[model samples]
Target chain A: MARVVVDVMPKPEILDPQGQAVARALPRLGFSGVGEVRQGRHFELDVDDTVDDETLAKIAEGFLANPVIEQWTIRRVDA
Target chain B: MARVVVDVMPKPEILDPQGQAVARALPRLGFSGVGEVRQGRHFELDVDDTVDDETLAKIAEGFLANPVIEQWTIRRVDA
Candidate 1:
């Protein structure tokens, strides 16, 4: 079995309320030096060796992420 | 400004319904080679040079992630 890691993030132009919430909370928590905080999704998959990069990309875009607002990248993780 | 990326993942013993949903959907989507799927949260923060590793970890645990079930790691991203 092979392991793959996928990272899904919002487009730079998109507004991320969750991130903003965290950013705002940071100052209250005494970490006033922190700036923008963007939140995203990370996925780890265990797959058969037959799964190729293209297939992984397809899965990431078609199933794991919203292609319209989010972009994802897949990388093979050493087992 | 320095960039830092934080990855928050569910503990290995915890149940991940979101990941399971994705795994189940994969077969229906014709990507049957996939196995276990685990979902996590990723955060990217822009911080001043004054922010140290310990502070980053604190932010990640206290605000960005739930330290109980989710474990997070922080890394500096190249500009």
Candidate 2:
């Protein structure tokens, strides 16, 4: 089996409350010098070796993520 | 400024409903032959140049992820 990783992040313009909450909490937790934080989704897939990059991209774009609000990248990882 | 990515994923033994939902949805959306899907969190951190890997990992462990049920990896990315 081939391992695939998909990183999906919201468009820069979108407001991410979950990220903001983490950013705000960091300072309270004594983590200083931290900058902006944006949160998104990460997906790991175990697929057949026959799956190609093109097919993975289609899966990421068509099902794993919503193209309208987020952008995703697909990469193959060692199993 | 430096860009850092923290990938947080649920422990393998944990149940991931969100991932299962996606896996189920994929076939309905016409994407077939996909295997198990695991979902997690993706975080992008913009930090000062002086921030070292140790500090980044600390932030990921102390603030971004829950060590008990999830595991996280920290890496630097191109700006």
Candidate 3:
């Protein structure tokens, strides 16, 4: 088995309200010198060892994510 | 500076509709043997060198994430 890690984030031009809110609230959380906060999601997916690159790309685009608002990268790691 | 990695995932019992959807769609995307898709998010935050573990824990809880539906962990890495 192979492990795939997917990190998904909002497109740069798109406004991220959650990230903005986090940035604004961090200081109040007691870190007086903190700067920006960019929020995103990380997924650990277990892919079959035999999967190919092209098929993985299609999985990423089709249902693995929402391409309009998010970008994802997959890295294969030891199972 | 130090780097912090945060991985946010829906609590195990909480329904991850998006992840479930992805799991179902993978087979159609030509990954015939794909099993599950538990999607989450990852973020890398640069922390100042002076930060202590206690303050970092506050940052992880208060503003760095949503405690109700999400859980996050931070790791210090070289900047």
Alpha carbon lDDT at A61, candidate 3 = 69
Determine which window of 10 residues in candidate 1 chain A has minimal summed lDDT. A25-34
- Every model's DockQ: 0.92, 0.81, 0.59
- Output the worst ten-in-a-row residue range by lDDT, candidate 2 chain B: B25-34
Per-residue accuracy of model 3 over B1-79 as CA lDDT, tens digit each:
6777777777877788888877787666556857666776666666677878788787777655689988777787676
Which lDDT value does model 3 have at A67?
97
Q: Could you say which candidate leads in lDDT? A: 1
> How do these models rank on lDDT, best leading?
1, 2, 3
Candidate 3 lDDT tens digits, A1-79: 6777778778877787877777677776656655556677777677787877777777776765689998878777786
Candidate 3 or 2, higher TM-score: 2
TM-score of each: 0.96, 0.92, 0.79
Ranking by DockQ: 1, 2, 3
Model 1 bad stretches (over 4 Å): none
Error of 2 at B35 (Å): 1.1
User: DockQ of candidate 2?
Assistant: 0.81
Pairwise DockQ winner, candidates 1 and 3: 1
Query: How high is the CA lDDT of each candidate model?
Result: 0.90, 0.88, 0.73
Between candidates 1 and 3, the lDDT winner? 1
